[model samples]
Structure formats: structure tokens, C-alpha cells
Target: MIDVLVAGGGPAGLAAAVHARLAGLTAVVVEPRTAPVDKACGEGVMPGGVASLRALGVEPAGRELRGIRYVDGVRRAEAPFRDRPGLGVRRTTLHRALHERALGLGVRIVPGKVGEVRQTRDSVTAAGITARWLIAADGLHSPVRRRLGLELPGGPRGRYGLRRHYRLAPWTDFVEVHWSGQGEAYVTPVADGLVGVAVLSRVRRGYDEHLDGFPAL
Candidate 1:
């Protein structure tokens, strides 16, 4: 029997297991994929998010960016915030670091997907492994949540998302979020002279909508 059986191995799951172990509990994470799994994310951690990482003994992935400017469908303006800067990191870099940290803390990483899970009085059984608690940190489309009949709030009605990556350098001291009538663009620094740009829109259209528009990136 285990104290906790965590489904999924993303940031949330890894964080939970690490904390659980620090609090003196037997934790195990069931995940199918290994480290460095590709994802569609901004690759930048907000100031507060970075602070959370520090609590877990993890460092920021890239240099901090301060010149954050938000645009309103056309022009841009500095966001009203009283903070130093946000940390820009690559998705793979952060994932690898956290995976390593979790392993260092005596976390059991099982390379198996949670095919099934059941609950009983004071216990939960995921597949054949039983534990006192079950955590569903898989991702947006979490199977555990669906099995447990949990619902998460959705975004606005007219909002949609489209994320793709490109090969670029990690430049700029701050992430640049461009607001446009077509959609919203988020840029984060991944490495020296390399950047990761993501696109989010209120309309669900083809991903190549801006493949020819963005010249600099």
C-alpha cells in the first residue's frame, strides 16, 4: 500500500509528489511518457510561479524579463505591475529539471499509464496499485477527472487556442505579449538568442494562420 498514487507526471503531479515526500509520505507517480516530452506552452514562468519553484529547490530556467508590455488588439503598453521580472525558460528544460529533482527526492517514477482506477472506503486503487490518495495531475484532458465526474471552468466563449513552435534565439529581457484583432501572441525566451512563440485566438482557425505574417520570429 502507498500513501499516495499520483496519475500523470507534469509539473503539478511532480510538485505534489515532491511535497508529499517532504511531508513524510510514500508517493508514486504513474506516467507513460519520459522526460522532455514536447508541449505547447509559453515556456515562461511568472514571477510568483518562479517563487513557487524556489520553494521546491528548483531554479529558474532562463534569465528574467522585465519589459513586459501588453497590447490591446493593436498597440502595446506596459502592464501595471510592481515586480522585478518574469523567468523565461524552455518547456523541456523545466521538465528535465523537475524530473531530476523529483528523482533526487526519492520519488518513485513508474513508466505506466493509469489504465483504470477505483475507490473504496479510505482508499483508491489505480489499476492494480492501491493507495490512500489519488491525484489527477495529468493535463487539461485528465481521465481521472472525467472518471470522478469533476468539471473545470472553461475560458470565455469567443476564445480559442493555437500553439506552435519555431527555431529562434532567446532574446529580449521581457516577454512580449502582442494583442491583435486576429488573435493574441505570447513570446518567451528559451535560450540565449532563441525564443518560443505561442498564438492564442478567440477564433478556432488553422494553425498556419500566421506562418507568413510574423517576419521577425
Candidate 2:
């Protein structure tokens, strides 16, 4: 039996496993997906988050970000970080780095999905594995949360985010936020020759539809 069993193999789950191992506990992560998982996100690790990752001995390969820039075609504003710089890393790169670190720390990763969770006064069991504690890092629509009756009521509709990568050199070190009448577009340099653009808007639209408005991009 392990001391900690984590559901999901995403960043949170892997991080939990690493922390458990640091605390001298045997931890295992059960995830349905394989390593180097990709997800749609801004993919920007802020300064504090970068420090946290460093503390876990995870330094992913990516571009160093200076700060943020807001542009509306006419007006432009920029803010540089005062202390540590942020990182713009791809989801896959970040995942692979964390996965490697977890493995090096003796965190066992099992391949399976957690269905029903059973617990006793001293132990918790899921996916036929028993542990002293269970961590539900299953994400937004977490099955563990639902099965444990911990899910909260649905809230109002939220904005949708879409991301796409372009094979182009970065124009600036600062992350660019292009504000439009409809929504905002976040542009970050993930590598020396790659730039990721993500749009957040209330209305669901294709990448081309959103990019059409940002001619300067």
C-alpha cells in the first residue's frame, strides 16, 4: 500500500506525487493518459509558479518571458517583471519534464482510470489500489469529485479559449495581449522559432475568424 494515491496524471497530480515523495511518503499516480499530455492553455508560467517548479527540480525547456504587453493597434502598454522572469513553455514540454522528475523520485505511475472510491477510517482505495490518503486532481469535470458528491452547482457560462501555434520567430520578449472589441488574444513565444496565440472570448469562433480581426498580429 502506498501512502498517497493520486488520480489523474496532469500537472497537479504529478506535483502532488512529487510533494508526497519529498515528505518521505510512497506515492503513486493513476492516469488513463500517457505521459507528455497536451492541453489547451495559456501555457505561461508566472514568476512564482516558476519558482515552485524549480523547488520541485523541474526546469522545462522554453522561452524566457520578460513581462506583459497590451496593444489595441492604436494604444500600447508594457510592464516588465521586476524580479524573476516568467516562462512560456508548451504543455507537452512541461508535462514531460514533470513526468521525468516524478519517475526519478520513485513515484510509480499506473495506467488506469479511477472509477469508484472506497474509504475507511484509516485508508482510501481507488482503482483497486489502497493508500493512506487519496488526492483527486482529476480536473474540471472530475469523476472523483462527482463520485464523492463534492461537485458544486454549475455557474454562469464562461469564456472559451482557443490556442494555435505558429512557426515564426518571436517579435518581442514580452507576452502580447491584443485587445479587440469582441475579446482578447494572448501571444506568447514558446520557443525561439515558435509562437503560440490563444484567444479568449464569450462567443465560440474559429481561429481564423478571431485572427482576422487582429491584422497587426
Candidate 3:
């Protein structure tokens, strides 16, 4: 039986698998997607996130936006947090880096959607796949957690976020987060002559609803 079976391949799951293998656990990750999977994020790797990744020996695959800038946000002031440093990288890059790191450390990645998980006193079977223990690192809405009878709910209406890539050079080494009354938008530079920009709002609105208002977007 496997020591641990992870139910997702996202950042959290990837991180957990890397750490788990380093700890000498026979771990496996069940990812539903084949490859070139993506996430809808501004792709900014906060300094803290980078430090943690470095500790795990994860080499980043995307360009790093060397500095951090704070946009007033959809509701806050434009001043910097000053308390900490943030790294801006793409979500896909982060995923790829973590994916490799996990594999190098000997984590088995099962690339398929988990159907069900049955638990007994000594072992847990995920859709007939058995393991000594199971970790549900799926997305915010984790099916594994649901199957195990745990409740995962959304946080109080958070900003709605959207992102796009551009082929121009970056405006600054720092990631620029822009704020409007509706929400916040973030900009980051990634590899391949592209820049990643994200728009966030507390209320859910149609895509391109505020595109005209933001000239930079």
C-alpha cells in the first residue's frame, strides 16, 4: 500500500508531495489532467512562496518579476505592504516546477480524476485505489474532502480575478497591482516575451465588464 495518495496536482498538492517524498514517504499524486495544465492566477510568486520553494529546491520555470508593487486594490490604498516581499511568476511555471520537483523526489503522480474514496480502519481506497493514508489537495472545492465528509467552503465574497498575457516588454521589475472600486488587478512578467495581468473584484461580473475602464489592461 502507498503511504500517501494525494488527490490534486495544484501548487498545494505539488508542494505537499515534494515534502512528503523528502520525508521518505511512499507518496502518489492523482492529477486529472494530462499535461500543460493551467490555473487562473496572477502568477505572482510572493517572496514567502519563493522561499518555501527554495527550501524544497524547486527551480522556477518562469521569469521572476524582481520587485513588488501594491495597487490600491479594488478598495484599499496604493501604498506598499512594506512588511514583506512578493514574487511574481506565472501559475503554469509554478506548476511545472513543482511537478518536476515532486517526481525527482520519487513521488508517484497518478494522472487521472479520482472517482471515489473508501476508508477503513487501516487503509483508504480512492476509487478502488488503496493507500495507507490519503491527502485531499484538490482545489478549493475538493471532492476527496467531500467524500471523506469534510466541508470546504468559499471565503467571504473575494475579488473576482481574470488574467491575460501580452508580448511586450515588462513595464517594471515590480509587479503592479491596480485598484478600482470594484476590485484589484495585478500585472507580472513571465517567460516567452509575455506579461501576465489579472483583474479581481468582490462581485462576480461578466468577463470584459471593466476592460474599458482600465487603460493598462
| Best-performing candidate as measured by TM-score | 2
The sequence of per-residue lDDT tens digits that candidate 2 reaches over residues 77-179 is 9999999999999999999999999999999999999998998999999999999999999987787988999878882447888899999999998999998
In model 2, residue pairs whose N, Cα or C atoms come closer than 3 Å (at least 3 residues apart or on different chains), thus clashing, are: none
- Alpha-carbon RMSD, each predicted model: 2.9, 1.8, 3.2
Q: Which is better, 2 or 3, measured by lDDT?
A: 2
Per-residue alpha-carbon lDDT of candidate 3 for residues 47-138, written as tens digits (9 for 90 to 100): 77777998999867666555666655244334343555555667777788888888888888877877777779999988557889888888
Model 3, residue 203: what's the lDDT?
67
TM-score for each candidate, following the candidate numbering: 0.85, 0.92, 0.83
Off by over 4 Å in 3: 72-85, 152-160, 202-207
| Model 1 CA deviation exceeding 4 Å by range | 72-74, 152-171, 202-208, 211-217
Clash totals for all candidate models: 7, 0, 8
Candidate 3: the clashing residue pairs are: 43-89, 45-87, 46-87, 47-86, 74-183, 116-127, 159-201, 160-201
Q: State the lDDT at 146 in candidate 3.
A: 69
Among all candidates shown, the one with the greatest lDDT: 2
